[model samples]
Target: MLPTTRGDFWAEITQIGMDRLWMQRFHVSLPQVSTVASRPGRRSIGFLTECNSSPLQHCGLNVLSGDIIVNKFDLAHHRSGADYHLGTMSLPTDELDTAVEVIIGRELLKSPDQRIVHPHPALMSRLLKLHKAVGQLARDTPDILERPEVARALENELVHVMVRCLAEGASADTTTGVRRHDAIMARFEEFLEANPDRPLYLTEICAAIGAAERTLRASCEEHLGMGPIRYLTLRRMHLVRRTLLHSDPSKVTVTQVVTDHGFWELGRFSVAYRMLFGESPSCTLRRPAEQPNIHLSRPSSLTTAEPRAT
Candidate 1:
Protein backbone atom coordinates (compact mmCIF):
# COMPACT_ATOMS: atom_id res chain seq x y z
CA MET A 1 0.00 0.00 0.00
CA LEU A 2 1.20 3.53 -0.69
CA PRO A 3 1.74 5.80 2.30
CA THR A 4 -0.83 8.42 3.31
CA THR A 5 -0.48 11.49 5.43
CA ARG A 6 -2.56 12.18 8.51
CA GLY A 7 -5.44 14.66 7.99
CA ASP A 8 -5.02 14.29 4.23
CA PHE A 9 -8.41 13.81 2.55
CA TRP A 10 -8.55 10.26 1.11
CA ALA A 11 -10.90 7.44 0.25
CA GLU A 12 -10.70 3.87 1.47
CA ILE A 13 -9.94 1.31 -1.26
CA THR A 14 -13.35 0.36 -2.66
CA GLN A 15 -12.59 -2.82 -4.67
CA ILE A 16 -9.75 -4.98 -6.00
CA GLY A 17 -10.64 -7.70 -8.46
CA MET A 18 -9.06 -10.16 -10.94
CA ASP A 19 -7.46 -7.46 -13.05
CA ARG A 20 -4.72 -5.47 -11.34
CA LEU A 21 -6.91 -2.36 -10.97
CA TRP A 22 -8.17 -0.29 -8.02
CA MET A 23 -9.70 3.12 -7.14
CA GLN A 24 -9.11 5.83 -4.50
CA ARG A 25 -9.28 9.61 -3.98
CA PHE A 26 -7.49 12.43 -2.10
CA HIS A 27 -7.91 16.13 -1.48
CA VAL A 28 -5.22 18.70 -2.35
CA SER A 29 -4.39 20.28 1.00
CA LEU A 30 -0.77 19.29 0.45
CA PRO A 31 0.52 18.00 -2.88
CA GLN A 32 1.94 14.46 -3.26
CA VAL A 33 2.09 11.53 -5.74
CA SER A 34 2.34 8.57 -3.37
CA THR A 35 -0.19 6.52 -5.34
CA VAL A 36 2.05 6.16 -8.42
CA ALA A 37 3.11 2.56 -7.68
CA SER A 38 -0.40 1.06 -7.81
CA ARG A 39 -0.61 1.30 -11.56
CA PRO A 40 2.34 -0.92 -12.57
CA GLY A 41 1.34 -0.58 -16.21
CA ARG A 42 1.80 2.44 -18.41
CA ARG A 43 -1.22 4.01 -20.15
CA SER A 44 -3.31 4.21 -17.00
CA ILE A 45 -5.01 7.51 -16.02
CA GLY A 46 -3.04 7.88 -12.82
CA PHE A 47 -3.95 11.46 -11.94
CA LEU A 48 -5.61 14.54 -13.39
CA THR A 49 -3.84 17.85 -12.90
CA GLU A 50 -5.37 20.49 -10.65
CA CYS A 51 -4.40 24.18 -10.16
CA ASN A 52 -1.76 23.42 -7.58
CA SER A 53 0.87 22.09 -9.99
CA SER A 54 2.47 22.65 -13.36
CA PRO A 55 0.89 21.13 -16.50
CA LEU A 56 3.10 18.07 -17.03
CA GLN A 57 2.06 17.13 -20.57
CA HIS A 58 3.15 18.76 -23.86
CA CYS A 59 0.12 21.03 -24.43
CA GLY A 60 0.09 24.36 -22.59
CA LEU A 61 -3.36 24.63 -20.99
CA ASN A 62 -3.44 26.69 -17.80
CA VAL A 63 -3.78 24.86 -14.51
CA LEU A 64 -7.00 26.22 -13.05
CA SER A 65 -7.83 25.98 -9.35
CA GLY A 66 -10.70 23.52 -9.86
CA ASP A 67 -9.31 22.13 -13.11
CA ILE A 68 -8.42 18.42 -13.07
CA ILE A 69 -5.33 16.92 -14.78
CA VAL A 70 -6.52 13.26 -15.13
CA ASN A 71 -3.03 11.71 -15.19
CA LYS A 72 -2.53 8.51 -17.18
CA PHE A 73 0.71 6.64 -16.56
CA ASP A 74 2.83 4.01 -18.24
CA LEU A 75 4.40 2.60 -15.11
CA ALA A 76 7.18 1.03 -17.19
CA HIS A 77 8.80 4.48 -17.26
CA HIS A 78 7.83 6.90 -14.51
CA ARG A 79 8.37 10.52 -15.48
CA SER A 80 9.81 12.63 -12.73
CA GLY A 81 7.12 14.16 -10.46
CA ALA A 82 6.87 17.55 -12.10
CA ASP A 83 5.38 20.28 -9.91
CA TYR A 84 1.60 19.89 -10.20
CA HIS A 85 -1.45 19.04 -8.11
CA LEU A 86 -2.21 15.57 -9.51
CA GLY A 87 -5.77 14.55 -8.49
CA THR A 88 -6.75 10.88 -8.60
CA MET A 89 -10.25 9.91 -9.68
CA SER A 90 -12.06 7.09 -7.83
CA LEU A 91 -13.25 5.17 -10.91
CA PRO A 92 -11.80 1.71 -11.61
CA THR A 93 -8.77 1.49 -13.89
CA ASP A 94 -10.90 0.02 -16.66
CA GLU A 95 -13.43 2.83 -16.39
CA LEU A 96 -10.66 5.37 -16.64
CA ASP A 97 -9.30 3.60 -19.73
CA THR A 98 -12.71 3.56 -21.31
CA ALA A 99 -13.33 7.18 -20.40
CA VAL A 100 -9.97 8.23 -21.85
CA GLU A 101 -10.75 6.35 -25.07
CA VAL A 102 -14.12 8.03 -25.35
CA ILE A 103 -12.69 11.43 -24.52
CA ILE A 104 -9.89 11.15 -27.07
CA GLY A 105 -12.29 9.92 -29.70
CA ARG A 106 -14.92 12.55 -29.02
CA GLU A 107 -12.52 15.38 -28.23
CA LEU A 108 -9.40 14.90 -30.39
CA LEU A 109 -9.42 15.06 -34.20
CA LYS A 110 -5.80 14.07 -35.02
CA SER A 111 -4.84 10.96 -37.05
CA PRO A 112 -2.81 8.03 -35.75
CA ASP A 113 -0.32 8.12 -38.61
CA GLN A 114 0.73 11.70 -37.79
CA ARG A 115 3.39 11.65 -35.11
CA ILE A 116 4.85 14.68 -33.26
CA VAL A 117 7.73 13.55 -31.03
CA HIS A 118 8.95 16.62 -29.17
CA PRO A 119 7.21 18.39 -26.30
CA HIS A 120 6.29 22.06 -26.78
CA PRO A 121 7.48 24.10 -23.80
CA ALA A 122 5.45 27.17 -24.76
CA LEU A 123 2.28 25.14 -24.99
CA MET A 124 3.03 23.60 -21.63
CA SER A 125 3.23 27.08 -20.11
CA ARG A 126 -0.23 28.06 -21.38
CA LEU A 127 -1.74 24.85 -20.01
CA LEU A 128 -0.58 25.93 -16.56
CA LYS A 129 -3.19 28.70 -16.50
CA LEU A 130 -6.04 26.28 -17.12
CA HIS A 131 -4.73 24.13 -14.31
CA LYS A 132 -4.87 27.11 -11.98
CA ALA A 133 -8.51 27.78 -12.87
CA VAL A 134 -9.42 24.17 -12.07
CA GLY A 135 -7.55 24.37 -8.80
CA GLN A 136 -9.48 27.50 -7.81
CA LEU A 137 -12.73 25.75 -8.58
CA ALA A 138 -11.78 22.77 -6.43
CA ARG A 139 -10.86 24.99 -3.51
CA ASP A 140 -14.02 27.08 -3.74
CA THR A 141 -16.47 24.31 -4.49
CA PRO A 142 -17.29 22.28 -1.42
CA ASP A 143 -18.50 18.67 -1.48
CA ILE A 144 -17.88 17.95 -5.17
CA LEU A 145 -17.88 14.20 -4.64
CA GLU A 146 -21.15 14.25 -2.78
CA ARG A 147 -22.78 15.52 -5.94
CA PRO A 148 -21.64 12.98 -8.53
CA GLU A 149 -23.53 14.48 -11.46
CA VAL A 150 -22.24 17.93 -10.71
CA ALA A 151 -18.70 16.66 -10.30
CA ARG A 152 -18.78 14.82 -13.62
CA ALA A 153 -20.24 17.89 -15.27
CA LEU A 154 -17.42 20.00 -13.91
CA GLU A 155 -14.87 17.49 -15.19
CA ASN A 156 -16.37 17.52 -18.66
CA GLU A 157 -16.47 21.31 -18.71
CA LEU A 158 -12.80 21.43 -17.75
CA VAL A 159 -11.88 19.18 -20.68
CA HIS A 160 -13.82 21.30 -23.18
CA VAL A 161 -12.40 24.47 -21.75
CA MET A 162 -8.89 23.14 -22.13
CA VAL A 163 -9.54 22.13 -25.73
CA ARG A 164 -10.75 25.66 -26.51
CA CYS A 165 -7.80 27.14 -24.72
CA LEU A 166 -5.49 24.97 -26.79
CA ALA A 167 -7.10 26.28 -29.95
CA GLU A 168 -6.73 29.89 -28.85
CA GLY A 169 -3.11 29.35 -28.01
CA ALA A 170 -2.52 27.72 -31.38
CA SER A 171 -4.14 30.68 -33.17
CA ALA A 172 -1.73 33.04 -31.43
CA ASP A 173 1.26 31.06 -32.78
CA THR A 174 3.12 32.85 -35.59
CA THR A 175 4.01 29.64 -37.41
CA THR A 176 1.24 28.75 -39.85
CA GLY A 177 2.38 25.14 -39.71
CA VAL A 178 1.74 24.87 -35.94
CA ARG A 179 -1.55 26.76 -36.25
CA ARG A 180 -2.70 24.25 -38.84
CA HIS A 181 -1.73 21.42 -36.51
CA ASP A 182 -3.82 22.92 -33.74
CA ALA A 183 -6.71 23.50 -36.11
CA ILE A 184 -6.73 19.83 -37.06
CA MET A 185 -7.01 18.73 -33.44
CA ALA A 186 -9.74 21.27 -32.76
CA ARG A 187 -11.77 20.33 -35.81
CA PHE A 188 -11.24 16.64 -35.18
CA GLU A 189 -12.70 16.85 -31.69
CA GLU A 190 -15.68 18.80 -32.97
CA PHE A 191 -16.28 16.29 -35.71
CA LEU A 192 -15.95 13.37 -33.33
CA GLU A 193 -18.54 14.60 -30.81
CA ALA A 194 -20.97 15.41 -33.62
CA ASN A 195 -20.59 11.90 -35.04
CA PRO A 196 -20.03 9.75 -31.96
CA ASP A 197 -22.29 6.96 -33.21
CA ARG A 198 -20.83 6.78 -36.71
CA PRO A 199 -17.95 4.64 -37.92
CA LEU A 200 -14.73 6.70 -37.86
CA TYR A 201 -12.08 5.77 -40.41
CA LEU A 202 -8.60 7.30 -40.32
CA THR A 203 -8.90 8.83 -43.76
CA GLU A 204 -12.37 10.19 -43.03
CA ILE A 205 -11.27 11.76 -39.77
CA CYS A 206 -8.21 13.40 -41.39
CA ALA A 207 -10.17 14.61 -44.39
CA ALA A 208 -12.95 16.00 -42.25
CA ILE A 209 -10.45 17.84 -40.08
CA GLY A 210 -8.62 19.04 -43.20
CA ALA A 211 -5.23 17.89 -42.01
CA ALA A 212 -2.55 15.67 -43.50
CA GLU A 213 -2.13 12.27 -41.87
CA ARG A 214 1.41 13.01 -40.66
CA THR A 215 0.68 16.39 -39.06
CA LEU A 216 -2.52 15.26 -37.37
CA ARG A 217 -0.86 12.16 -36.03
CA ALA A 218 2.02 14.18 -34.63
CA SER A 219 -0.36 16.59 -32.90
CA CYS A 220 -2.27 13.69 -31.37
CA GLU A 221 0.91 12.06 -30.14
CA GLU A 222 2.17 15.33 -28.73
CA HIS A 223 -1.03 16.67 -27.19
CA LEU A 224 -3.41 13.75 -26.57
CA GLY A 225 -0.92 10.86 -26.19
CA MET A 226 -2.81 8.40 -28.38
CA GLY A 227 -3.24 7.23 -31.95
CA PRO A 228 -6.52 7.94 -33.75
CA ILE A 229 -8.21 4.53 -34.02
CA ARG A 230 -7.32 3.25 -30.57
CA TYR A 231 -8.52 6.48 -29.04
CA LEU A 232 -11.85 6.32 -30.89
CA THR A 233 -12.41 2.70 -29.93
CA LEU A 234 -11.72 3.45 -26.31
CA ARG A 235 -14.11 6.42 -26.39
CA ARG A 236 -16.88 4.27 -27.84
CA MET A 237 -16.30 1.58 -25.27
CA HIS A 238 -16.34 4.07 -22.45
CA LEU A 239 -19.63 5.54 -23.54
CA VAL A 240 -21.06 2.03 -23.79
CA ARG A 241 -19.90 1.22 -20.31
CA ARG A 242 -21.35 4.43 -18.91
CA THR A 243 -24.65 3.77 -20.62
CA LEU A 244 -24.70 0.24 -19.25
CA LEU A 245 -24.04 1.45 -15.74
CA HIS A 246 -26.44 4.37 -15.79
CA SER A 247 -29.27 3.26 -18.08
CA ASP A 248 -32.08 0.87 -17.27
CA PRO A 249 -30.80 -2.54 -18.39
CA SER A 250 -34.37 -3.76 -18.97
CA LYS A 251 -34.86 -1.03 -21.54
CA VAL A 252 -31.57 -1.68 -23.37
CA THR A 253 -29.79 -4.84 -24.50
CA VAL A 254 -26.01 -5.01 -24.16
CA THR A 255 -25.58 -5.29 -27.92
CA GLN A 256 -28.00 -2.45 -28.55
CA VAL A 257 -26.23 -0.15 -26.14
CA VAL A 258 -22.76 -1.00 -27.39
CA THR A 259 -23.72 -0.65 -31.03
CA ASP A 260 -25.52 2.58 -30.40
CA HIS A 261 -22.31 3.92 -28.90
CA GLY A 262 -20.32 3.09 -32.10
CA PHE A 263 -18.96 -0.28 -31.05
CA TRP A 264 -19.45 -2.55 -34.08
CA GLU A 265 -17.37 -5.63 -33.22
CA LEU A 266 -19.16 -7.29 -30.33
CA GLY A 267 -16.44 -9.79 -29.48
CA ARG A 268 -13.61 -7.27 -29.53
CA PHE A 269 -15.69 -4.74 -27.61
CA SER A 270 -16.52 -7.29 -24.93
CA VAL A 271 -12.89 -8.27 -24.50
CA ALA A 272 -11.58 -4.66 -24.34
CA TYR A 273 -14.37 -3.55 -22.01
CA ARG A 274 -13.70 -6.47 -19.66
CA MET A 275 -9.98 -5.78 -19.58
CA LEU A 276 -10.57 -2.15 -18.59
CA PHE A 277 -13.49 -2.45 -16.15
CA GLY A 278 -12.70 -5.85 -14.53
CA GLU A 279 -16.16 -7.17 -15.29
CA SER A 280 -18.38 -8.02 -18.25
CA PRO A 281 -20.94 -5.67 -19.81
CA SER A 282 -23.61 -7.87 -18.27
CA CYS A 283 -22.35 -6.98 -14.80
CA THR A 284 -23.07 -3.32 -15.33
CA LEU A 285 -26.52 -4.26 -16.61
CA ARG A 286 -27.46 -6.12 -13.46
CA ARG A 287 -28.57 -3.41 -11.07
CA PRO A 288 -27.45 -4.59 -7.68
CA ALA A 289 -29.24 -3.14 -4.70
CA GLU A 290 -26.17 -2.96 -2.52
CA GLN A 291 -22.93 -1.20 -3.39
CA PRO A 292 -19.83 -3.27 -2.74
CA ASN A 293 -16.85 -2.12 -0.73
CA ILE A 294 -13.71 -1.71 -2.83
CA HIS A 295 -10.11 -0.49 -2.68
CA LEU A 296 -8.59 2.14 -4.97
CA SER A 297 -5.06 3.55 -5.10
CA ARG A 298 -5.67 7.29 -5.24
CA PRO A 299 -7.49 9.65 -2.87
CA SER A 300 -11.27 9.12 -2.51
CA SER A 301 -12.81 12.41 -3.62
CA LEU A 302 -12.45 11.97 -7.39
CA THR A 303 -14.41 8.82 -8.24
CA THR A 304 -17.77 8.10 -9.92
CA ALA A 305 -18.88 4.41 -9.89
CA GLU A 306 -18.77 2.02 -6.98
CA PRO A 307 -15.97 -0.55 -7.41
CA ARG A 308 -16.88 -4.26 -7.77
CA ALA A 309 -15.18 -7.64 -8.15
CA THR A 310 -14.82 -9.46 -11.43
Candidate 2:
Protein backbone atom coordinates (compact mmCIF):
# COMPACT_ATOMS: atom_id res chain seq x y z
CA MET A 1 0.00 0.00 0.00
CA LEU A 2 1.29 3.46 -0.93
CA PRO A 3 0.39 5.83 1.87
CA THR A 4 -0.51 9.49 1.37
CA THR A 5 -1.62 12.01 3.94
CA ARG A 6 -5.21 11.89 2.77
CA GLY A 7 -5.45 8.12 2.79
CA ASP A 8 -3.68 4.94 1.67
CA PHE A 9 -3.40 3.91 -1.99
CA TRP A 10 -2.73 0.23 -1.83
CA ALA A 11 -2.48 -2.63 -4.35
CA GLU A 12 -1.81 -6.30 -3.62
CA ILE A 13 -0.44 -8.45 -6.43
CA THR A 14 0.18 -12.19 -6.67
CA GLN A 15 2.68 -12.92 -9.39
CA ILE A 16 2.77 -16.15 -11.34
CA GLY A 17 3.61 -17.56 -14.84
CA MET A 18 7.19 -16.27 -14.86
CA ASP A 19 5.99 -12.79 -13.88
CA ARG A 20 3.17 -12.78 -16.43
CA LEU A 21 -0.01 -13.33 -14.46
CA TRP A 22 -0.53 -10.65 -11.85
CA MET A 23 -3.63 -10.91 -9.65
CA GLN A 24 -4.15 -7.54 -8.07
CA ARG A 25 -6.49 -5.71 -5.68
CA PHE A 26 -6.33 -1.90 -5.63
CA HIS A 27 -7.96 0.68 -3.39
CA VAL A 28 -7.57 4.37 -2.54
CA SER A 29 -9.45 7.20 -0.85
CA LEU A 30 -7.91 10.13 -2.69
CA PRO A 31 -10.44 12.47 -4.23
CA GLN A 32 -10.15 13.34 -7.93
CA VAL A 33 -6.98 11.35 -8.58
CA SER A 34 -6.03 9.87 -11.96
CA THR A 35 -3.99 6.70 -12.32
CA VAL A 36 -2.17 5.88 -15.54
CA ALA A 37 -1.41 2.16 -15.83
CA SER A 38 0.30 0.16 -18.56
CA ARG A 39 1.11 -3.45 -19.22
CA PRO A 40 4.30 -4.76 -17.67
CA GLY A 41 6.98 -5.25 -20.35
CA ARG A 42 4.67 -6.93 -22.91
CA ARG A 43 1.10 -6.71 -24.15
CA SER A 44 -1.37 -8.30 -21.76
CA ILE A 45 -5.05 -8.80 -20.99
CA GLY A 46 -6.59 -7.23 -17.92
CA PHE A 47 -9.42 -9.03 -16.11
CA LEU A 48 -10.95 -6.41 -13.84
CA THR A 49 -13.81 -6.66 -11.34
CA GLU A 50 -15.37 -3.65 -9.69
CA CYS A 51 -15.13 -3.51 -5.92
CA ASN A 52 -18.26 -2.09 -4.26
CA SER A 53 -18.97 1.65 -4.88
CA SER A 54 -15.39 2.77 -4.62
CA PRO A 55 -14.32 3.44 -8.21
CA LEU A 56 -17.67 4.62 -9.50
CA GLN A 57 -18.02 7.75 -7.32
CA HIS A 58 -15.46 9.33 -9.56
CA CYS A 59 -15.92 9.47 -13.34
CA GLY A 60 -13.77 6.43 -14.09
CA LEU A 61 -13.77 5.34 -17.75
CA ASN A 62 -13.87 1.62 -17.08
CA VAL A 63 -17.19 1.68 -15.25
CA LEU A 64 -19.36 -1.10 -16.71
CA SER A 65 -21.99 -3.55 -15.56
CA GLY A 66 -20.65 -6.98 -14.41
CA ASP A 67 -16.98 -8.01 -14.59
CA ILE A 68 -14.87 -6.41 -17.33
CA ILE A 69 -11.98 -7.77 -19.37
CA VAL A 70 -9.72 -5.46 -21.35
CA ASN A 71 -6.70 -5.87 -23.57
CA LYS A 72 -3.99 -3.44 -22.47
CA PHE A 73 -1.68 -2.41 -25.32
CA ASP A 74 -0.50 0.95 -24.02
CA LEU A 75 -0.81 3.42 -21.17
CA ALA A 76 -4.42 4.07 -20.11
CA HIS A 77 -5.61 6.81 -17.77
CA HIS A 78 -8.32 6.04 -15.20
CA ARG A 79 -10.02 8.68 -13.06
CA SER A 80 -10.99 7.79 -9.52
CA GLY A 81 -13.67 8.94 -7.14
CA ALA A 82 -13.15 9.91 -3.50
CA ASP A 83 -12.97 6.21 -2.60
CA TYR A 84 -11.42 4.14 -5.40
CA HIS A 85 -11.57 0.36 -5.40
CA LEU A 86 -11.07 -2.38 -8.05
CA GLY A 87 -9.50 -5.81 -8.61
CA THR A 88 -7.49 -7.14 -11.55
CA MET A 89 -5.96 -10.37 -12.87
CA SER A 90 -3.41 -10.12 -15.66
CA LEU A 91 -2.42 -12.52 -18.45
CA PRO A 92 0.67 -12.34 -20.60
CA THR A 93 0.79 -12.31 -24.41
CA ASP A 94 1.35 -16.03 -25.01
CA GLU A 95 -0.60 -17.34 -22.04
CA LEU A 96 -3.75 -15.38 -22.86
CA ASP A 97 -3.72 -16.63 -26.44
CA THR A 98 -3.13 -20.23 -25.44
CA ALA A 99 -5.90 -20.04 -22.87
CA VAL A 100 -8.27 -18.54 -25.42
CA GLU A 101 -7.45 -21.25 -27.94
CA VAL A 102 -7.92 -24.00 -25.42
CA ILE A 103 -11.09 -22.66 -23.83
CA ILE A 104 -12.90 -20.64 -26.48
CA GLY A 105 -11.20 -22.05 -29.60
CA ARG A 106 -10.39 -18.65 -31.14
CA GLU A 107 -7.26 -16.61 -31.84
CA LEU A 108 -6.79 -13.53 -29.59
CA LEU A 109 -3.19 -13.46 -28.36
CA LYS A 110 -1.60 -11.30 -31.05
CA SER A 111 -4.64 -9.10 -31.49
CA PRO A 112 -3.65 -5.52 -30.75
CA ASP A 113 -7.21 -4.28 -30.55
CA GLN A 114 -8.41 -2.83 -27.26
CA ARG A 115 -11.45 -4.81 -26.17
CA ILE A 116 -13.69 -4.48 -23.13
CA VAL A 117 -15.84 -7.53 -22.47
CA HIS A 118 -18.47 -7.79 -19.75
CA PRO A 119 -19.08 -11.28 -18.46
CA HIS A 120 -22.61 -12.73 -18.35
CA PRO A 121 -24.50 -13.37 -15.12
CA ALA A 122 -23.15 -16.79 -14.22
CA LEU A 123 -19.64 -15.84 -15.24
CA MET A 124 -19.88 -12.51 -13.43
CA SER A 125 -20.87 -14.37 -10.29
CA ARG A 126 -17.81 -16.56 -10.55
CA LEU A 127 -15.59 -13.58 -11.32
CA LEU A 128 -16.90 -11.75 -8.26
CA LYS A 129 -16.24 -14.84 -6.15
CA LEU A 130 -12.69 -15.03 -7.49
CA HIS A 131 -12.16 -11.38 -6.70
CA LYS A 132 -13.29 -11.95 -3.13
CA ALA A 133 -11.05 -15.00 -2.80
CA VAL A 134 -8.04 -13.14 -4.10
CA GLY A 135 -8.61 -10.29 -1.66
CA GLN A 136 -9.02 -12.70 1.21
CA LEU A 137 -5.92 -14.63 0.24
CA ALA A 138 -3.89 -11.47 -0.01
CA ARG A 139 -5.06 -10.36 3.41
CA ASP A 140 -5.03 -13.69 5.27
CA THR A 141 -2.58 -16.10 3.67
CA PRO A 142 0.76 -14.52 2.83
CA ASP A 143 2.58 -17.70 3.81
CA ILE A 144 0.47 -19.84 1.49
CA LEU A 145 0.92 -17.36 -1.32
CA GLU A 146 4.67 -17.77 -1.07
CA ARG A 147 4.42 -21.46 -1.96
CA PRO A 148 5.30 -22.06 -5.64
CA GLU A 149 2.70 -24.80 -6.13
CA VAL A 150 -0.08 -22.67 -4.65
CA ALA A 151 0.80 -19.69 -6.81
CA ARG A 152 0.83 -21.80 -9.99
CA ALA A 153 -2.52 -23.31 -9.11
CA LEU A 154 -4.05 -19.91 -8.51
CA GLU A 155 -2.74 -18.56 -11.82
CA ASN A 156 -4.01 -21.49 -13.83
CA GLU A 157 -7.44 -21.27 -12.24
CA LEU A 158 -7.66 -17.54 -12.93
CA VAL A 159 -6.78 -17.86 -16.63
CA HIS A 160 -9.24 -20.69 -17.21
CA VAL A 161 -12.00 -18.88 -15.38
CA MET A 162 -11.40 -15.66 -17.28
CA VAL A 163 -11.49 -17.41 -20.64
CA ARG A 164 -14.76 -19.07 -19.72
CA CYS A 165 -16.17 -15.75 -18.58
CA LEU A 166 -15.17 -13.95 -21.75
CA ALA A 167 -16.50 -16.69 -23.99
CA GLU A 168 -19.87 -16.62 -22.28
CA GLY A 169 -20.16 -12.84 -22.54
CA ALA A 170 -19.66 -12.65 -26.32
CA SER A 171 -22.94 -11.07 -27.33
CA ALA A 172 -22.94 -8.67 -30.28
CA ASP A 173 -25.28 -6.11 -28.79
CA THR A 174 -23.60 -5.94 -25.39
CA THR A 175 -20.14 -5.65 -26.88
CA THR A 176 -21.23 -2.94 -29.30
CA GLY A 177 -22.97 -0.92 -26.61
CA VAL A 178 -20.05 -1.08 -24.18
CA ARG A 179 -17.57 -0.22 -26.91
CA ARG A 180 -19.69 2.74 -28.09
CA HIS A 181 -19.89 4.25 -24.62
CA ASP A 182 -16.19 3.75 -24.04
CA ALA A 183 -15.30 5.24 -27.41
CA ILE A 184 -17.40 8.36 -26.82
CA MET A 185 -15.93 8.98 -23.36
CA ALA A 186 -12.42 8.39 -24.65
CA ARG A 187 -12.94 11.09 -27.25
CA PHE A 188 -14.23 13.52 -24.63
CA GLU A 189 -11.33 12.80 -22.28
CA GLU A 190 -8.83 13.21 -25.08
CA PHE A 191 -10.27 16.59 -25.99
CA LEU A 192 -10.18 17.76 -22.37
CA GLU A 193 -6.63 16.56 -21.83
CA ALA A 194 -5.35 18.18 -24.97
CA ASN A 195 -6.85 21.54 -24.01
CA PRO A 196 -6.19 21.48 -20.28
CA ASP A 197 -5.21 25.09 -19.64
CA ARG A 198 -7.93 26.65 -21.81
CA PRO A 199 -11.27 27.89 -20.43
CA LEU A 200 -13.31 26.58 -23.37
CA TYR A 201 -17.00 26.19 -22.65
CA LEU A 202 -18.68 22.76 -22.66
CA THR A 203 -20.58 23.52 -25.85
CA GLU A 204 -17.29 24.04 -27.66
CA ILE A 205 -16.05 20.71 -26.38
CA CYS A 206 -19.24 19.00 -27.52
CA ALA A 207 -18.80 20.45 -31.00
CA ALA A 208 -15.15 19.42 -31.16
CA ILE A 209 -16.11 15.87 -30.20
CA GLY A 210 -18.72 15.80 -33.00
CA ALA A 211 -21.74 15.24 -30.73
CA ALA A 212 -24.86 17.26 -30.05
CA GLU A 213 -24.87 19.03 -26.68
CA ARG A 214 -27.70 16.98 -25.20
CA THR A 215 -26.34 13.69 -26.53
CA LEU A 216 -22.91 14.34 -25.08
CA ARG A 217 -24.39 15.37 -21.75
CA ALA A 218 -26.56 12.28 -21.53
CA SER A 219 -23.72 9.96 -22.52
CA CYS A 220 -21.40 11.41 -19.91
CA GLU A 221 -24.05 11.28 -17.19
CA GLU A 222 -24.90 7.67 -17.94
CA HIS A 223 -21.37 6.35 -18.26
CA LEU A 224 -19.57 8.59 -15.77
CA GLY A 225 -22.39 9.28 -13.30
CA MET A 226 -21.70 13.00 -13.80
CA GLY A 227 -22.42 15.58 -16.47
CA PRO A 228 -19.81 16.98 -18.84
CA ILE A 229 -19.36 20.36 -17.13
CA ARG A 230 -18.82 18.87 -13.67
CA TYR A 231 -16.42 16.21 -14.96
CA LEU A 232 -14.32 18.76 -16.83
CA THR A 233 -14.23 21.08 -13.84
CA LEU A 234 -13.22 18.25 -11.54
CA ARG A 235 -10.51 17.20 -13.97
CA ARG A 236 -9.19 20.76 -14.10
CA MET A 237 -9.23 20.91 -10.32
CA HIS A 238 -7.19 17.72 -10.24
CA LEU A 239 -4.74 19.18 -12.73
CA VAL A 240 -4.34 22.30 -10.61
CA ARG A 241 -3.69 20.21 -7.48
CA ARG A 242 -1.10 18.17 -9.35
CA THR A 243 0.67 21.32 -10.46
CA LEU A 244 0.63 22.69 -6.91
CA LEU A 245 2.01 19.48 -5.45
CA HIS A 246 4.88 19.42 -7.92
CA SER A 247 5.54 23.15 -8.25
CA ASP A 248 8.02 24.94 -6.05
CA PRO A 249 6.33 27.60 -3.94
CA SER A 250 9.28 29.85 -4.68
CA LYS A 251 8.61 29.56 -8.40
CA VAL A 252 4.80 29.69 -8.75
CA THR A 253 1.72 31.17 -7.19
CA VAL A 254 -1.53 29.24 -6.54
CA THR A 255 -3.68 31.83 -8.29
CA GLN A 256 -1.49 31.84 -11.35
CA VAL A 257 -1.58 28.05 -11.67
CA VAL A 258 -5.34 27.81 -10.99
CA THR A 259 -6.22 30.56 -13.40
CA ASP A 260 -4.09 29.00 -16.08
CA HIS A 261 -6.13 25.85 -15.67
CA GLY A 262 -9.33 27.87 -16.37
CA PHE A 263 -10.70 28.00 -12.86
CA TRP A 264 -12.21 31.50 -13.10
CA GLU A 265 -14.33 31.45 -9.96
CA LEU A 266 -11.59 31.47 -7.35
CA GLY A 267 -13.86 31.31 -4.31
CA ARG A 268 -16.02 28.44 -5.55
CA PHE A 269 -12.93 26.63 -6.82
CA SER A 270 -11.26 26.80 -3.40
CA VAL A 271 -14.39 25.57 -1.64
CA ALA A 272 -14.82 22.69 -4.10
CA TYR A 273 -11.15 21.79 -4.00
CA ARG A 274 -11.19 21.72 -0.23
CA MET A 275 -14.35 19.67 -0.24
CA LEU A 276 -12.82 17.17 -2.62
CA PHE A 277 -9.21 17.06 -1.43
CA GLY A 278 -9.54 18.02 2.25
CA GLU A 279 -7.11 20.96 2.18
CA SER A 280 -6.81 24.52 0.93
CA PRO A 281 -5.10 25.21 -2.38
CA SER A 282 -2.47 27.49 -0.85
CA CYS A 283 -1.50 24.77 1.62
CA THR A 284 -0.77 22.41 -1.26
CA LEU A 285 1.14 25.09 -3.17
CA ARG A 286 3.38 26.01 -0.25
CA ARG A 287 4.33 22.48 0.69
CA PRO A 288 7.59 20.75 -0.21
CA ALA A 289 7.13 18.12 -2.91
CA GLU A 290 4.92 15.49 -1.32
CA GLN A 291 1.64 13.65 -1.79
CA PRO A 292 -1.38 15.55 -0.53
CA ASN A 293 -2.99 14.05 2.56
CA ILE A 294 -6.55 13.39 1.47
CA HIS A 295 -9.67 12.68 3.48
CA LEU A 296 -12.81 11.11 2.04
CA SER A 297 -15.16 13.09 4.24
CA ARG A 298 -16.03 16.70 3.39
CA PRO A 299 -16.21 19.64 5.79
CA SER A 300 -19.74 20.45 6.91
CA SER A 301 -19.39 24.18 6.38
CA LEU A 302 -17.12 25.15 3.53
CA THR A 303 -16.08 28.79 3.40
CA THR A 304 -15.84 30.21 -0.10
CA ALA A 305 -12.96 32.43 -1.10
CA GLU A 306 -13.90 36.07 -1.75
CA PRO A 307 -13.43 37.01 -5.38
CA ARG A 308 -10.67 39.52 -6.01
CA ALA A 309 -11.24 42.29 -8.56
CA THR A 310 -9.29 41.93 -11.75
lDDT of 1 by residue, 194-275 (tens): 9988688989888888888887788666545556676566556656766787778778799888888877888988887777
Off by more than 4 A, model 2? 1-18, 29-85, 104-150, 169-172, 175-181, 265-268, 287-310
Q: Give each prediction's root-mean-square deviation over alpha carbons.
A: 16.0, 9.0
lDDT of residue 205 for candidate 2: 88
Provide the TM-score for each candidate, comma-separated.
0.46, 0.65
**What are the per-model numbers of colliding residue pairs?**
74, 4
lDDT of 2 at 179: 50
| lDDT, candidates in the order shown | 0.47, 0.60
Q: Which candidate number has the best TM-score?
A: 2
CA deviation > 4 Å runs, candidate 1: 1-55, 58-176, 288-310
